[model samples]
Target: NNMAEAIASAIISYKKEYFGSQADVNYDKTLSSKAAESTKSKRIADNKVLKARNSNVVFKVQFAAGNKKIKLNPSNFKGLKNVSVRTRNGSFYKYAYGDTSDYAVAKKDLKEVKSKGYTAAYIIAFRDGKSISVEEAIKL
Candidate 1:
């Protein structure tokens, strides 16, 4: 189809017009507009994750809640990974799965989590990694 050649030509033209000589030197790295955009998006997402570690409010599926600490691993979590734990006053540990700011994504995760044998799993919200009501998280 020569699609790659066409895309390369387009990218070179775009760089020559918009970014000039310096961009031409880096043109091979970007390949196409979509690739350039994807790189930019990845950087943005990485920054968000860094920020989320400290201040972002996110929704997660709480699959296990108990006073005792259970080691987090695929074996412990029914072959599922990406698990995290939150505790209150060093008293109770809430084991949660998935981490996203999108409520819809959290809902979807909840459904999958239940299907994984965690029938009682539900969506929970956290602000700075502390438990908060779903309604409050949405408002924030």
Candidate 2:
């Protein structure tokens, strides 16, 4: 319901005299103000969206690390379908549905992947892929 309507309903529902000689109208005003303040405080808190300190951190763990595949934390790579891995030298590699398409092609095209200078790689979702530079990836 609307905030104004809710506040009005609360004022009406409060168990205090309204029309009698013992009616406490002043108390009703204080109660309404307190409720309004509480609701406003809650809304302000909920509106805040916290951002991650390290945005380059690729939560994915499973990737072909040379001949031997290396998997980090299983929970980190969960529900990841399409992903794009970026190398240190501004090269991009894409994979979908657990398919690592043409590792040789990626390795050849992305000179950074082959170079030891590559600081880090990012495995982000294709839908909401995180776009971060090599410097940021290294921080992750």
Highest lDDT among the candidates is held by which one? Answer: 1
lDDT of 1 by residue, 39-126 (tens): 3333444444322333378988867655567899889988878899766556556678999987657767877887888765656677
On the 0 to 100 scale, the lDDT of residue 60 in model 1 is: 83
TM-score of 2: 0.16
Q: Rate the local accuracy (lDDT) of all candidates.
A: 0.62, 0.31
TM-score of each: 0.56, 0.16
User: In model 1, which runs have C-alpha deviations exceeding 4 angstroms?
Assistant: 1-55
Could you give candidate 2's per-residue lDDT for residues 28-114 as a string of tens digits?
223344345434433542443212234333333113222212233433333333333333222222221222222222223223331
List the pairs of residues colliding in candidate 1.
none
Q: Tell me how far the alpha carbon of residue 106 in candidate 2 is from the true structure, in angstroms, after superposition.
A: 15
Off by over 4 Å in 2: 1-56, 59-93, 96-128
lDDT of 1 at 79: 80
